[model samples]
Target: MKFPVKNELLKRLFAAQGEPVSGQDIADEFGLSRTAIWKYIKELEEEGYEIGSMRKKGYYLIKAPDLVNAANISTYLETERYGRHIHYFSTCPTTQTIAHEEAQGGAADGTLIISEEQTAGKGRLARPWTSNAGRGIWMSLIIRPRLAPQQAPQLTLVAAVAIVRAIEDVAEIQPVIKWPNDILLNGKKVTGILTELQADPDRVKAIILGIGLNANQESEDFPDELQSIATSLKIEKGEHIDRAKLVAKILHYLEHYTALYIEKGFAPIKLLWESYATITGKRITARMVNETVEGTALGISSEGMLELKLDDGTVRGIYSADIEIKN
Candidate 1:
C-alpha cells in the first residue's frame, strides 16, 4: 500500500478524535472502494496499531504504536503550526540534509524531517553523530522567522531555551545549556543543536535547526569514547521515555519561544537561557577557528554571543567557538 494513503487514513482516524470514521466516508474521501479502506486498516493493524470497528461506525483508533510518525506525534502536538507537516523516515542519512533541501524548495515554515535512525548523522563542525536505531530523536525543523541575517543566530539561543523547557516538561530532569549549542545533563552531554541558515545578505529566508537528542539508550549504547561523556534520557531517568511526546513538547516550546523572540526581542530568551546555562560564571577555554581564549564566562550578550571576561579584565564576546570548562 502507498504510504500517503496509509498516513492520510491514519490522520483521518486521529482527527475523528475517538469517534468512529465511517468506512464509506473514508472511501469517498480517498476515491477508493470500501475494500481498499479495509485493506489499509489491516496494514495498520499489522504495524501494531490496535484499531476498532463498529457495525456502521467504521473504524476508530484504540491504540497507536510507539512510532515517531505523524500519526503518533500529532496526538501530542499542541502548537498551531509547528510540526503540522512532517516527513518521517524509518531510516535516513540525515534529517539536516533533507530539511535544507526542503527549505530551499520552499517548504512550510514548520515543516519537520524526522528519522528513526541516521546513517550519516552530523553535529557541529561536521562531526559524526551516533543515531542508534529506534532510539534518540533525530529531527530537523525548518523555521522561517522574521529576522535579519545577523539576528538569526539568536534563534539558536531561542531553541536552546525551548529544548530545556521541553526536557523539564517531559523527562522531569534539570538539563543545562552548555554555551553555544550543547545541552548537558549532570555535566554530561545529552543533546546537541546545530543551526544552519538559508538567507540572503539583507533578508532572512529559513533556518534549518537540527536537533539530535539521546532518548532511550542504555550505557552500552554509546561508543567507548562517548561512554564517559554522553548519556541518554532513559539512563538518567531510569526508564524509557515516549520519544513522540517529547518531540511534540519540544515543538510546542519552539513555536512559543520563537514567536516570543521575534515579537519582544532576545531579552526574555536570554534570561531563560541563562537560568539553564552551565558555563556561565565558570572558568573555560574557548577554541575558535583561529585563536583560543581562556576566560571566565560572563553570560550571553544581546546578540547571543558568549561573553567571556578575560584575565586582562577585558570582556570578549565570542561569536563562535567550542568551549571547555576549566574548573
Candidate 2:
C-alpha cells in the first residue's frame, strides 16, 4: 500500500515538533475533506502512532514507535529520490529478491524495498545472513545508471564509501571497508553490501544493491558461530542507536555518491573508497574458486578490482575473491 498522502501528513506533523496542528489546516493543505483527514489519522493511530487531539486543536504526535515503516522513515529522510518510493515489509525472505522483481516490473529509479526482518537473507557466496528482528537495516535499493554492463561492479565500492560516511555521521567510531563488500568496526563485521546487476548486452538496466547493517542489536543477539565475528552499532556505541535516522543518512549519502560516480568517474569514488579500506598495504590472501593468491594489497584498479602485488612483484587485479588479511 502506497502512503503518499499519509507520508506527507507525517512529515508535516513531525515538523510541528509535538505542537498541535489544526484539522482544518491539514484538510485545506492536502485538499482533503475533514472526514478524509480523520480517517487518515485513525489509520496512523492503528500503526502504533500515538496521536492526541484537543477540542480546538486538530492533532499532535505524542509518540512514534521505533519501526522502519514508510511513515517513520520518511519523517527523517532528506533525500530527493532515494527513499521516495519505499516498499516496506514487516518480514520477508529477502529484500534483494523483491527488488529484482520490482525492477523487472519497471519500478522507478531509486525505489527502495526495506524490511524489518529477513527470513532468508543471503551474503556473498550464498551464505546465510542473520537479520535479527527490528535490529538491522535490511534493505535493497533499485538504481538505473547509464553505464555499461562491465562497469556495474564499481557501484559496490561506491556504496561502501556511503555506508562508512553514514556511520561516521551518527556514531563516534571508525568503520573500514574490507575488500569488495564488507564494513568492519573494531576488526569485526558490522555491515555487508551485495550489488547485483540487470542489463542488456550493451547498455545497463538496473542495479539492485542489497545492504545489511547491524544497527541496534546486542552482542548476545547473534548465534554461537557469529558471536566472535559479528557486531552491531548498539554494542559499539554503548547506547541504542536510532535506526530510522541511520537509514535516512545512508540514503542521503548513497544518492550523493552515486550521482558523483555517474557525473565524474570512478577515480573520485576510488579515492574516497580507499580512505576507508582496510587492506591497503597489508599482506593478504585472496581465495577464488579456481585458485588462491597471496600478495600485498595494492589499491583498487580503475574498474574497481582489488590490485594485489604477488610474491614475484606481479600486480594481479582480482575481480571477485574472498580476501583474508595475512598481516
Candidate 3:
C-alpha cells in the first residue's frame, strides 16, 4: 500500500543480489512478518519484479522491473535529492490527489507520485484528463517553494519549459508549448499540465504540479472521443517513446528552473518559456472561465500571465484561460 515501507524492503532484497536473504532478516529489518514479506514479494512480482525462491535460499532478487520505481529513478537522477523519494502505483484516481495529500501530511519537497493509469485525472478547470492505462506518463511533483502566491503561477510556465526541453532531449522532436499548459506536437495535443496550490491569500504552502504526457500510445489506443484531438509520441514519431528517459529529463529541467526562479526571479524563465511558446504573436481566442476574448496574443508578462491586445485598443491580462489559435 504505502510505498515508502515497501521500498525499504525492495532495497534490502535487491542488495542481497543473487544471494538469498532469509525471511527473518527482512521481518526484523521492517518489523513485518514472514507472511507479509511473502505478500510484498508477490506484489512486486505482479509489477514485473523478478524474484527467485528456493527451499533453503529464502528469496533472491533476480532483476528489478523496468518501471518507475524509487530505486530506478534514483539511479538515473544525479541530484543528491529530488525524486529520490517516489511513490508508484499501478492505478490510482489521480497522482495529483495523492501528491496533495502527501504534501499536506508533510511529505518532503520534491516527492514524486506517479501511476500507470489515472481513472479520475483532472486538468485545468476540472476538465477530465484522459489517461489510458499503461499508455502514458501520469505523474505529479510535490514542491514546497518559498514564494508568494502571486509568483506561484510561474511554476506552470517553468514546468512547460522543462517538459518541452525533455521531449526534445529524449523524443528528439521539438514540441512547443501552446501558451499556458498544453504541449503540442505536429499541431496535435501531446501533453497537458495542471498546477494546484495549497496556500493562504498571500503565501504558498505547497504546490502540486501534475503532468500528463502521451508517450507510447498508438493512434488507435486512444478513446473515440480523443482520437481526433489527441496524439501520442508514438503517433508523432512513428515509434514508441522511452518513458523513463523523458521522465528523468523532465525532473532535471524542473529542478533547474525551480531553483532559478527562487534564486533570481521569473524574468529569466518567462523569457525561456516565450522562446519555446508557439502561440505568441498569433491571432487567438482565449476562453476564460467567465468569457471569451479575441485578440492578438502578445506575450506572457514578467509575472507569467498572458497579455492580449484586443481589437478595441485595450490590453487585457489573462490570469488563466484556454487558448484557441486562429488560422
Candidate 4:
C-alpha cells in the first residue's frame, strides 16, 4: 500500500523556496478546489510545518519539521522498492501486527510499518520487548521474497547484518550478532530482530521483519530490569542521535542485502554474517525448549543452521535454541 501523493501542495511549496505559490496555481495544476488546498495546508501545519500566508501572494514555506513520518523518510529514501510504502504511527500496539495484516491484504513487497511506541511489543518466543515511546526504532518490514519455507530462517540473519551495518554507519558503534537475531554492544543487548513468516512448507508468502533499535534513550529510560542488560545508542555514544537518518540508513542496507540474497543466494550473506557473529568458535550451550545442549560453536551450516560440536566427536545442527557462551 503506497502512501498516496496527497502532499503535492507541500511539495510545490518546497520547490518554490521562499516564493509564494498561489492557491489558484495549485488548484489548476492538481484540479483541486481552493478549499482543498486550504485543507492540505492545515494538514501540513498539523505535521509541524510552518507556512507563511500573505494578502495576495498565496502560501510560502517557512520551516520543515523534524519528524520521522512518511514525508521525512521519503525525502531520504534511496531504495527502488523496499520501504517505499511506509505506514507511520506515533503510537501503536505493534508494527508486526500491522505489517502482517497489510501483507495478507495484498500489500507490496517492501511495506514498512513504523511506530514511535508499541504498547504490546514482542520479542523472541512471545517475550515482551521494551519499546519506549519516541526513544527507539520500533518498525517492521513486510517482504515477499521468492524463497522456500526452509530458507525462511535465514532472513533473520540477513536482517541482523543490515541492522549492524546501519548502526556502524550512524552510531559508529561496533555491534556483535549473537546467533539467530540479537545484537550486542559492550556485552549488552542493543538491538533485536524478530522474523516471522507466513508461508507453507514449499513456497514463501511474506516475511515480517521486526527490528527494535535503542537509539536516543538513556540508561534510566529503560526499566530497572532492563537497565543492566539493555542499552541505547545515545547512552553509549554520550550524545543525542538522529533517528530519522538512522532509519534511512537501515532501509538502504536492508534493501541492498535483501536484493543480494534474492539474486546471488545465501553464500555472500553468510560470509558477511560470520564476520559480525561472535558465538562461532566459542564454547557455548544451546538451551532448547526441552533439553540444553552444550558444545563448541562450529559456525553455521550452508542452510544457516547453528552447527555445534558436541562433547562427542559428532557435530550437530541446532534449529532453535538460546545460545549462551560458556567460556
Model 3 per-residue lDDT tens digits across residues 107-201:
98888898888999888888999888878899999988999987888899999999998898888888888878999988889999998999999
Best by TM-score: 2
Q: What TM-score against the true fold does each predicted structure earn? A: 0.89, 0.97, 0.82, 0.87
Tens-place lDDT per residue, model 2, 1-327, is 358778878777888989988888878887999999899999999989999988788788899878888788888888888988999999999999999999999998989999999999998888999999999999999999999999999999999999999999987688999999999988999999999999999988999999999999988899999989999988988988888888888999999999999999999999999999999999999999999999999989999999999999899999999999988
Candidate 2 displacement at residue 182 in angstroms: 0.3
Cα shift from native, residue 298, model 4 (Å) = 2.0
lDDT (Cα, 0-100) at 48 in candidate 2: 90
Q: What ranking emerges by TM-score with the best candidate at the front?
A: 2, 1, 4, 3
What is the alpha-carbon lDDT of model 4 when measured against the actual structure? Answer: 0.87
Q: Which stretches in model 3 have alpha-carbon errors above 4 Å?
A: 1-66
Candidate 1 structure quality by residue, lDDT tens digits, 1-327? 126567778877888878898888868887999999999899889888999999988899998877888767876778888998999999999999999999999899999999999999999999999999888999999999878899988888899999999999999999999989999998889999999999999888999999999999998999999999999999999988999999999999999999999889999998999998988889999999999999999999988999999999999999999999988
Score residue 66 of candidate 3 by CA lDDT: 51
lDDT of 1: 0.91
Residue 203: error of model 2 in Å? 1.3
Candidate 3 minimal-lDDT segment of 10 residues: 72-81
Question: Among all windows of ten consecutive residues in candidate 1, which has the lowest summed lDDT?
Answer: 1-10
